[model samples]
Target: MNNVDEDNALVNFEDDQADDLDTSLAVDRFRDAVLYGTDWTVRTLLQQIEQGNIDLSPDFQRRDAWSLRNKSRFIESVALQLPIPQIVLAERKEQRGTYIVLDGKQRLLTLAQFAGDFPDDHPLWDESRKVASLRLSGLRVLTDLNGKTYNDFTSLPDLAQMRTQFDNHTIRSALIRNWPDEDYLYEVFIRLNTGSVRLSPQELRQAMKPGPFTAFLSIKSAESVTIQKILGLSAPDFRMRDVDLLLRLIAFSTRLSVYRGNLKQFLDETHEFYNANWGVEQKGMEGLLKRLEDGLIFLCAAFGNERHVGRRYKGDNFESPLNRAVLDVQIASALDENVRRAVEEGRLDLLGTFQKMSINDQEFAQAVAGTTKSITAIRTRYNSWRAALEGVIGQPVQMPELPNG
Candidate 1:
């Protein structure tokens, strides 16, 4: 939850959909619930327990697989005088019996997952620990404010007697419509998923990527299996965050930066670019990748020779500027001239030496702290490095590629 929430902002799913409902007359009533009232999805809670993942016990293999400590905190906070998530009907109607969950899957799932009616893995399902069961037990369906009480599904008069008769209470039914289309479903999913634990765009990208990518993960897992056994370790965490860095690098490398949408779209466009350009002929992308790889390799060589190594390549911070030089190479390449001159000349190595040179030989022992590093100085240093790299690599520096007029 903590990891997922960092990059996303909360979206009010209920408020957005209040005006759009299936029924005309019930619109205001629904609006009242969406706007001022709360109609807890009785069905969602029931479904959650049925899904069989509410085991808080440690021994349970599936206990909090998604790491929902924040969710527990939110629920506890709401219960024990903390600000609760404002009830939002982050759900919408589609066809029937299956509502398009607009914004509240996490909350609904939490409710169902924490309902203390049954043991973690209850047999016979006898003890109903789901929220629906708990909510229905003392079910005094809060009636509408104007006049009548037993208005909608909640305020039925016989529900009290029904609860008294049975040790359990269940919703008679829910009034929601089902929706198809994964994209539409995702929109609803995202809209409804609004909360403090708002998922990152990359997280959403991971969740929404289609079969091939998912299969790639599985294949990678199998490949990593032998590696783990040999090394007695696990795979590295290189998901959307890494992808974001890679995308920026690629964008900068390609000298194109217009395609900015969700992670899915970004990746899709990147893949398309590779397929159309690199994968097909190996002329454009191959050169780009090779130049990037060689530049880094040359940069590393220069760094080692100059006794300035070990700093990792951060794509955005350092590589972005270097990408400008790459764009320069691309321009030189278009002109059919000496390209990749920076890498050939070991410009980055010179820059690294320059940076190290700025600090005292005694102060070099200290980490990169208490130093005023300016962008202009960095650029100047890069130019110095570029001059050196150009001298060594013998490639002409060029600019970013633009559309031919």
Candidate 2:
């Protein structure tokens, strides 16, 4: 959502004004005022940035394209570790109070942009900033859980001077009784975000929700932990969408198959799945999963293949009959001994048997139908079989552990 036009007030400060104003004391006093509503200080914001958890949403910063030079500036600031720019916020008198961002989008974005562990060679890297911005580069500021602690700022301890300066550096919010038009806000978001590091549509969605499911995944194709770990998550990886799919796969496979609709529906249903009989079923599945893991390790030992299979399947390993059928099935099965028996008795042959298994479930059927269009029908059918086998094993494994709250 855009809100540029909705923000009816704007404050323009020239470098001269900033240079002349003794803002330290005023900043200190205004700290309390700012804290009352936003409750964020330079310390807290920086801490979140270092933690790579700041909310760079429409409410915080606009979506925009960021050039390498812009990224370098951000990296320079991080390397210098300077205090993040002060944000001026105001409250709106709507149904519930809403906070408005008054200034500091560029500086705030610089913090949010480079906060993540971007590759070392990228222009935005902290090390690069150090090498490039030699003078300001060496100065590193300390960050707290609330705001930034600057040696330069704190060095000036004149209380009266600081107080007077803070008063002079006035930052306030303006609210409206009637809500601004949605189009105005949208335009604001776009205009502010244009020509900067713009957020994607999916990223925007994640910001709106900002919950467990939403919080779980929010990276671009350039960086997908799921692709790195999960078997078969390929390039052009659908970052959040992939995570959403995985969660759904796990949820549906666990017996919430009836409720697997959109990501939102599955997330809501997950809570109920935990409370229902499936909880016990999932536990059984987990125990079986452990057994299967042990069994796979044993199989690896038997096969003399000692390499680690990361948490999820990926690439050729994902499509491997050995992984998709035997490993996946055995892992999901609740009956360890039964699985062992099956493997010993050629039950592991289920990898090939996947082709023979009937597709009766609606969810699986639809998946097969949809996937077959892109991949071969045979491959889709096999994948469905793989999921079913894994699902069966998963149900009997110890309760499908809900993510730790």
Candidate 3:
């Protein structure tokens, strides 16, 4: 395929929703044990923020995802004594005294930023960085407080009275006490974190889920210098895209054939299975990571800098997404005796063999780079590539068809 075709294919599965749920899959039902904590004043929460009793997992929460308007609107809601959403906290099992935010982080963060020196991102945050001079924007019902900061009161009595009211404003809170494990917490977070806007799959996974697998992914993603370079990503991706990519790798490498149409659903399914069987699957998961590294080494040896990965094309648009889709399939299908042995020995003459397969095998290209989610595309590519790879390496091997996408 030409660059134009590759470009089109680069968008493979951009908005692809997996086929409907598989009926045979098990249903997960859970009821969490939660402590409905007593009502809290705004002063109490602000004090907690100052004392660092509330721990916002910096890895997950550092993105300034909320806009300034979002901050202003929320602040106005609190200022007007509106009934705000209850704050949700997961009492950290390890950190005996601290809490990790499970929901309403934006609310807490907005309040903290508002009360302190004005964050330049805020609407009232002028060049001087003073929040005391703040003004409310888009205040509908509380128009009297508009264009006035806490320090803008002309009368001392009025200022003290308003300050007392603001400080005494109540914030209801719920505590997820005594979570059995990180897995349960993660599930709860996923269930509640969705508001009008949804959280990303990876973000949901990391929020409260504690497990060997997710923990390992977090550690590996942060330390994966080589993996990041191979996949053409910046190391220590704060947004956790690399971690998301890792999940996709694990999902596709192990579960490609059974892939229902929806990527998120497939991932959620994978998450449930892994969390349930992590003790048994941990060794195998490690092996998959090793094989992935081997696969990347093989690809770089075979394709050099033209990895067909990354967002921007060196000679093509970012095929990182496409490259991942293809690579996962290839690794999972590497059951052929010859291919397996080559990978085991670390001496696969990948460049010569890949070139020959590309030249002599037209179907190979189509299968590798066609419509990404078609069953035909999934089945034909793996089978054809296996055949071509084996032929160039000299073997006729039998392998199962790749599962549905």
Candidate 4:
């Protein structure tokens, strides 16, 4: 990826102020959680996984991040009766006994894959396939166990005792039940996962709000050549930043009037509602996606594909990294029916108008850069672009009314 693509892939416009809320309130909310400690033997945990009592949500970030060597080392640790970090699970309220793995997913998955008992239809099945009946490697102590799989132990009497020890090895687990709500659970998940191997906000969003709408975002993002070109992404972004941009476009275009400056909450609510009612709202969502794609295609054709969403000042020889704020206003304005027709009819110089504003307009520049997540900044970009387009398009340009807050 070029610098532009790399920058866009890491863009996150959510207001940091949202994260600065009262810590005392947050701590109080977490106090409502009911948790208990227990231990599960390797065989029992794998059995739970096989029986569908434990859910390793497919949308989990870095579900298969562990390498074969790392997995082997973990298995070796279990065989040696070494202490392992406790896993955290949340009991599903809807399905009493069933639980969702909140942390230590890779560890549990490693255990199952090495035992050659991982379910083929599992969420991590594709990654697990590469290490099924995983042969031990990179052993520091029991070097003799190298190159041997779990199945090998069954036929080799010398390794039979080791196999038994592995199966009986108990792992400590913290099971959380009777949470206040999914919101609370989501907070818990965020707190738990924000350690050394942290998940990005988009990753957490996708994992916390899995459903048809989430699936739709992934599929549409992968399929849209126009989106890929405009974002300079040759493939879907692993960090899900591409999807985050798409979500922003959808939310601002369709529900801008409802936005109240909390970008994260706004996006989260949108995901929750649409995911819950996807069957009824699928068609409308698809139409919104198509509109955004059409706007993107037009921008790409008017400006070079690589320069369309990038920022360029009057004196700058090269376009700056993709400006997400520029992306927002440009796409939103391009979606207007009158604006599109004007450009198509050779009446409006869309590219020239965009260049003039980007190079000369101080307020617009700041709106797209500094304090971008603020409601005022968001409104400034849209209103400023609307005025600029109207000046050239020779007519009023419609834009969504933003909230005062």
Candidate 5:
């Protein structure tokens, strides 16, 4: 987190696995999308953004991660009349003529910030609520423009022509107006964003499905000290990987009965459902998060940090990076009142039992590694962990019955 090297060392559980099962269907679905290209001058685009015709979703606003230097360089490129990449936009189905940004968010935001006209409510703003003006720096070609801001150009007669050139610079944009549904639009967004800096699926989902539930996930993930410690993160992940793991916990713990093997679809459905019904479901979701936190804290106290959610197989010297499947079942089982009481009352040696199982259980080991998103793997890990806990607790530990598929 604070140390760049240590932060880079944290492992992602699903890095090797495919997010979704079917790709041919997605390709077939997108074939019908109606897309057209247009060029918009910087002046016109800024006007649209100011008039609220262009929608920068809350998630996109949160991910304005470019530094001031980066923004200034981009402005320098515009000043030099360098070619810029095209942006992609999808028309909002609910509000005609208004469009949501699917790509080039940083570019657009940089333009607004450099022009000293970015919205004050935008997440990029500091606590002072003042619009940040970008001063050009690190310009190789336009070296004389360094330290100059848009306001400086307005005030200085010599810089007036340079400001006009920047305003008249046109950037190409591909607009999709007739998408069948949000799903198709999300696919388009994902495809458009496959550049040098690729977005994680959860990041895309956050942008596409912004609502109370998504906000809850982000806030809770950031606030949870236990989760941050377990994951070895000093701060919230830039790509929202921490949020992705928390979503897995919430989905499996609350909606296991409806899971049908596809982790991506299941998580997406959970987001959509909770977002749509957050008014009534907020309290229940809050309870779930509290239970998860309690479970995590108990595990840390009992087993210490290294072995909290890390996986170790037979003959292994060190624990593997935090395993999503292991975390899911362990935390879910710990949420049971009986299991917690048994462990706290000294009737059960939870750590010893877990270590024995980790060293000897093949089914459990396989379920936590390799391909873990399938129905068989999920059920195996949950049921196996529940059985292990039940044997130690001397009582039945309740778990949701997953689908047979």
Candidate 6:
């Protein structure tokens, strides 16, 4: 995580261009703009949901991020006729005019559960069933309405006014047309959420860009027993730090030299490259997955835990970057399909070689020294490990020609 210097941050800014811009200029640049509209009332949105026009199951920031207390407060906000943040959605790639919520899943979920099961006639409502009524739990402005559910408004004698207020409330929205070639919606989502420190880099990418590559990584990590054995994730770490660690292996191993030392930029570029061909390049993604799987199986066979992966600190925790840098280069250099299989299925033992290299390797030491984030450090550490891996293989391994992206 190299910090961008101050001089570099304002490099894209311009002070003299404010008056020269035109509406047509923006429209021309964003000619791929598909379904651009905003300002929908809650009633209009609900009608769309009921008519089977809206998709509530888009990959969200976090499906279960809102606690009951948070949901309760949100409901209260809507009930009070307050303006909520705009919800954004993208037209589904597979279904024309069908849309998926990009930004406001929690808000929509709370509304659906409160209003009762997406009206039962909606298409997604059956597959994505609403659980039950969510009774209001918290109230700052509407204290008297703290415990009411939507059902109570219809049947009860005293609560009719509250129902009308809730149903008539408005929430703004933005819909992006799912253009074929350009990632207009994805880029918009990234720009909108970049300032949020609440999300991790991978989490944001996974949510913003969903495809086979993302699905593959999630499934692979969930099913890997060996990975869990190697690096037990810390409790309360919901940011998918473990998955990112494995991804670090693939990204750096494949393109070690092209790495410019900024992890956010590196990962952002890598994800864009992978996501660009979501449906059209499934075969390529599968091949990449195969190489990564081979490397993972090989490494697990060679090492036991985090201690074997990186420098052990005095506090007993292992340094993750050093561990990852070493693994990335080692696996990348020897990940020729045949070599990886030989190490994994051929019962080769390189524990002694790795153990000795870990202790005596000067480049490994330099990799973690200074800021483990610079290009110099990345190259040194990865180069050192590549050499170490080659020594164990009893042959010089060739670095693969890889894309800059």
Tens digit of lDDT per residue, candidate 3, span 225-311?
Answer: 555565444444434556776787777767766775555567777877787799999898888787676665555544555344322
Reference-based lDDT, each prediction: 0.33, 0.35, 0.58, 0.73, 0.74, 0.57
Clash pairs, model 5 backbone = none
- lDDT top scorer: 5
Candidate 5 residues 107-126, lDDT tens each?
Answer: 88778777736567654444
TM-score of each: 0.35, 0.34, 0.51, 0.73, 0.82, 0.57
Better model by lDDT, 1 or 5? Answer: 5
Model 1, total clashes: 21
The predicted structure with the larger TM-score, 2 or 3, is: 3
What is candidate 1's lDDT per residue for 38-62, written digit by digit as tens? Answer: 3333344454335442211211111
Rank order by TM-score, top first? 5, 4, 6, 3, 1, 2
Residue pairs with clashing backbones, model 3:
18-261, 18-262, 19-261, 182-210, 257-403, 310-320, 311-318, 313-316
- Native-to-model Cα distance after best TM-score fit, residue 404 in candidate 4, in Å: 5.4
TM-score for candidate 2 = 0.34
Clashes in model 6: which pairs?
A: 35-177
Which portions of model 6 miss their true places by more than 4 Å? 1-28, 31-37, 50-52, 58-62, 92-96, 119-132, 178-180, 198-327, 330-382, 389-405
> Candidate 3: where is the Cα deviation over 4 Å?
1-55, 58-200, 208-210, 309-322, 333-337, 340-371, 396-401
Better of 2 and 4 by lDDT: 4
* Tens digits of lDDT, candidate 6, 168-196: 88888888774542235444544566555
